[model samples]
Target: METIIREDTPKTPYVKLDGEKGVVEIKGRSIPENSVEFYKPLIDWIDEYGDDPKDNTIINIQLEYFNTSSSKCILDIFKKLELLFKKGFKVQVNWYYEEDDEDMFEAGEDYQSIINLPFKMIEMEE
Candidate 1:
């Protein structure tokens, strides 16, 4: 599968999905004007990746901020990972947050509560 790579902009996050390495990362602020357009292809890519079934799939999400639409997209991504886990793939999520960002840390914790896959809330010095 081809990787998804998009540099971060003021309104969107950076997406780097390396199918070969089984590491997918989405970092930066995500408040895209067209959330559906920005996330559709990513959702498709994850669907394809889930089919082939990698041994380990690690998704790292470090978002400084996001809008409601983007939050929905993130939930969609988590659902995809849940599906992969159900199919017997080793899946993990590392949700990175800045040291002093309580809201971001809590958001990660909230996501962890909703999803069945293993999730790690990581604190990064910013």
Candidate 2:
């Protein structure tokens, strides 16, 4: 599968989906006007990657901020990964939040509670 690389824009986040490395990264801000449209390809890519996934998959998310719609789109991505995990694949989410950002930390915690997968809450320096 081909890797998906999207640079961050004012209303979108940077995304890198590397099937070879089994790594999915989403960074920066995600506030797209049409969140679903913006994330559809990524979600589809995850679905495709699930077919012949690597032994271990790591998702690194380091978002400065995101709108509610983007949050749902993110959850959709996680749901895809959760399916992979249920199939006995090694999948993990590394949610990186800046130190002292209570909202971001809590957001990660919320996702951890909702998703059936291992999540590492990483604190980065602001």
Candidate 3:
């Protein structure tokens, strides 16, 4: 599958979904006017990628901040990943939060608790 890349904007995150490499990355702020619309293609791409996913899939999430609507969209992405994990493919999510950012850390923990996929909370220097 072709790689999907979206540059980060003031109100959206940078996204790179490489099916061939089995790597996904999302970074920056995500408070789009229409969260669902902004993330629909991404979710759809994951669905398509699921048909013939790589043996090992990794998603790196490094968001500085996100609004409530974006949070739901993020969860949808995780749910999609959860399905892939259940199918027996090796999947992991690396959630990166800036040092001293308690809220971000807790957000990662929240997603970790809800999703069955393995999650690694990474602390990054501010």
Total backbone collisions, model 2 = 0
Candidate 3 runs further than 4 Å off:
none
Worst 10 residues of 3 by lDDT: 109-118
TM-score of each: 0.96, 0.99, 0.98
Q: lDDT tens string, model 2, 26-101?
A: 9999998899999999999999999999999999999999999999999999999999999999999999999999
Q: Report clashes for each candidate as comma-separated counts.
A: 0, 0, 0
How large is the C-alpha RMSD of every model relative to the true structure? Answer: 0.9, 0.5, 0.5
Evaluate candidate 1 by giving its C-alpha RMSD to the native, one decimal.
0.9
Tens digit per residue, CA lDDT, model 1, 13-120: 999989999999999999988899999899989988988967999999989989988988999999998999998889999999999999999898888888898998
The TM-score-based order of candidates, best leading, equals: 2, 3, 1
Pairs with steric clashes in candidate 3: none
Tens-digit lDDT string for candidate 3 (54-115): 99999999999999999999999999989999989999999999999999999999998888
lDDT (CA) per prediction: 0.91, 0.96, 0.96
